[model samples]
Target: NFILFKTISSCLFFFFFFRSYGGKILVFPFDGSHWVNMEVLLQALHSRGHNITVVRNSKSWYIKENSTYYNIITVPVERGIDQEFITNTTSGIMEFERGALPLTSFLHLTVTIFHIMIEVHKIFIDFVLAMLNDPDFLKMLKYSNFDLVLTDPSWGGGAIFAKYLNLPLVYNVRWILAKEAHFSLAPSPVSHIPITGTGYTDKMTFLQRVKNMMFYLLAQIHYYLMITQTYQQLCEKTLGPNIDFNELSLSADLWLMRVDFVFEYPRPTMPNFVYMGGFQCTPAKPLPQHLEDFVQSSGEHGVILMSMGTFVSALPADMTNEIAAAFAKLPQKVIWRHKGDRPANLGNNTLLVDWMPQNDLLGHPKMKLFVAHGGTNGLQEALYHGIPVVGIPLFFDQYDNLMRLKERGGAQILTLSTVDKENNFLKAVEEVLNEPSYRMNMQRLSRLHRDQPMKPLDNALFWMEFVMRHKGAAHLRTESYRMPWYSYYSVDVGLFLFGVFLLVVTTVFILMRCLYRTVCKPKVKQE
Candidate 1:
């Protein structure tokens, strides 16, 4: 009887696993934050018995391997220009903040953006060459027969590699789409869709729209000057001649963007573009006893969690003191994730630690507000838990994210450039806490965000499988991708109509002049 039961269990396991047709899934992720976002989805895929392989950079976070389902192939690449530029540029931006001056003018901003794009192109070229230089890796990839490739859309190397391998490509954007990517995938009217750094929304004033258009045009110029030739060279070297990365990316089978209307403004989307925001979010676990006790002791004032995420952990001493002073005055208990020495002015209501379970803490019933650097992951988690925020955005897309939250009325921004940092921070904190409207708006959005018919992860899984099963789901692709720019925008049709109008006006004017000369001038002729 024991043998019979064991045989039955073994047969059932084989029946489920073998019948499902698990395939080899290859992932290409670029940065630390991107890797963190991909881990959740990768792990889920592995658990379903698919073999997952990752082409990873040495600097990225670790991915634990399993003998049965996971493998990691590390590629050694130097991040030379990008590292130095980012460090120097962000430091310069901070120095201006300390001096209480405007950080950048339009010209400076455009020049800086162009420099970054050029540096990024250099780094991406090196990445592609590194993989191509390794013969063993190339051979492995060629023979592995991957069913689908999930890649970062921001990194053009992945698109080149996917085209070379002749696999169906799926883009997994860890953040909101960059302007160019969004434009290629769907129609984005400049009047409504705000660029990542501009902080505008769907409703735009005329001047704002003009600014948006300038930003868009500048981005196009930057791409042409900095990215186009270099990207084409890399593609030619690896995947044969005349293969355009932009064209290949437009042909990608699916685009899974990490955004939803809950946090993003409403915009036109295509059939192939999927909104899989909050895929990394999960039901929060119970906080450990010590943390729970710390929060519960705060009573009515409750607790607030502060984190700058993994990238920007360091803060200037003066700014640190200013923040500590505000925390010192608040009745609410503060839990701060800090890397440097603890601030000297920390009050009894504050606790400083090197690490934090941020999601768990935010989900606590006693949790009241969040002090965030406005990273997308943290913001999404905070929103999912229905916590309001006092946002202090420093760089990158933080400004835009914070602005969106303020537009939604769930957050208030207090930058370091404010005249009185301590006072502004305190006031912002008090306003969010004292006002019932902020929390009420947060609750409403949170409910809408959570009330989806299917969870984001499940939705992603379904579509991923759908693509694999259908062998790229080519039927869903838009005809716009195949059309020329002039055809897609009806430029030629507009030109033809204008020409016809001009011809009709010319003919009418000529006839009118003829009538004047032949009849109206008869009396003068006779005289």
Candidate 2:
């Protein structure tokens, strides 16, 4: 009886201990694909008894008005990045990729992308104004007394809101305001660290490095013109003229980066930047009955899974026909997530579903290869499942994500322009499937990724709780962002030392010349 009483007491103690540590978190999330990952984090937090309130636009693409895990504070807006905008932008990029003139296509793509970015940021700014201008909403937020603001830093509204609330800020981050989070928070040397969209790796030739530097410069220009100036105006109008949006972006107490070295190339990172790559990945659950039957039917030949992620619902008709025709040539059964008109060339071995269980399908024993658009979440899931990939990157960071895996010998990349021509899709798929090295290398990566001391999700949770408990992690944050460019690089000190060296050399030379004239002139006169 005494022993039973002790066990009960211990159980109660632990239960209360966890219950007391539950925090109130205010989440500002980016919609679309980013929300998919953020929702994973939110669910975990919800299971841990944390109170999560998500701030979303009324017309958000993926985020709904209702959720079991979190409360929603929807900001009504006339404009938001909806499906139509994404579809149009993606279609334009596709057209540009297929254009005959390379230089002209490149220029058009750049201009179109920049214009889209400007429009998106303008919408984000409008959302921020709507929120700030609402007195009742502001009062409700202020009184909530949240422990920390957890946000994806892709958009600046969250960071701005956190500052306005005077709450501790934490980031569930991969991308920041205008670039990758690492470039904003770490020492990103262009010589080795390739900028996004460059299609180069850490090991670069001289010309590649030159191109990398140029891209880095272009990113900086984009940040200054599109992000800094635009957001700075909002900051001044809302918070104060003294507030710096760039510095605010870097001021997160903890950065839960969505990548680890197993997937990302080795590079310098900040103390507060914690990598939790593949945190959203979990062991596969049993597939749906029909899906299970389909997998079982594949027999010894195995299966290939294809998804273009959340953004690209379907490809152009001709391209889809090319892909479908190529799939017809393969022995393996194909399960494709396609949301468009049925392709006439689609084979008997292929099944078209509006959606498939991507992670579960990847983890299945019959799964042989993945045909993906190279989204980070999808690639990470593939890595977790030890599956080789044939990457057909469409836009944004997709190509870069694939390039990382290709560099590691676990994946093959095919450009959109080349994928439809000369049986490239079939060739690339066949190469990955037949190549022993592709699967072996990917399995090796899987081992390395799984060999972590702690699971990525647990690590992320611990740091988040650490921030909540401590109020903030200011000590781990660097003041380098506050430094002027000359001071940060020590250029001023180098110039000062150079000037001192010149002065000393000139003084010594002058003394030696005088000594020679004074001593030698008298001797010559005596002679």
Which candidate should be chosen as best, given lDDT against the real structure? 2
For each candidate, the alpha-carbon lDDT, in order, equals 0.78, 0.92
lDDT of 2 by residue, 286-400 (tens): 9999999888888999999999989998999999999999999988999999999999989999999998889999999999999999999999999999999999998778999
Candidate 1 all-Cα RMSD: 4.4
Clashes of 1: 0
The Cα error of candidate 1 at residue 526, in Å, is 11
Clashing pairs for predicted structure model 1, backbone only: none
Candidate 2, residue 387: how far the Cα is off, in Å: 0.7
TM-score per candidate? 0.89, 0.96
Q: Which residue pairs show backbone clashes in model 2? A: none
Tens digits of per-residue lDDT for model 1, 1-527: 99999999999998896557787888877564666678778888887777889886654444443334568887787763333455566666666555653545445655665666677667767877888899999999999989999887777777777788888888887432235356666898888998767878788999999989987876666655654657767776677676765576678888887878899888888888788877888878988889988989999889988998756655777778778888899899999988767778878888998888888898889899999988888888888888998888876678788887789989988776772453887888889999999888888878989999999888888788788878797887887867777988899999999999999999999999999889978889789
**Lowest lDDT 10-residue stretch of candidate 2:** 99-108
Please estimate how well model 1 matches the true structure, expressed as its whole-model Cα lDDT. 0.78
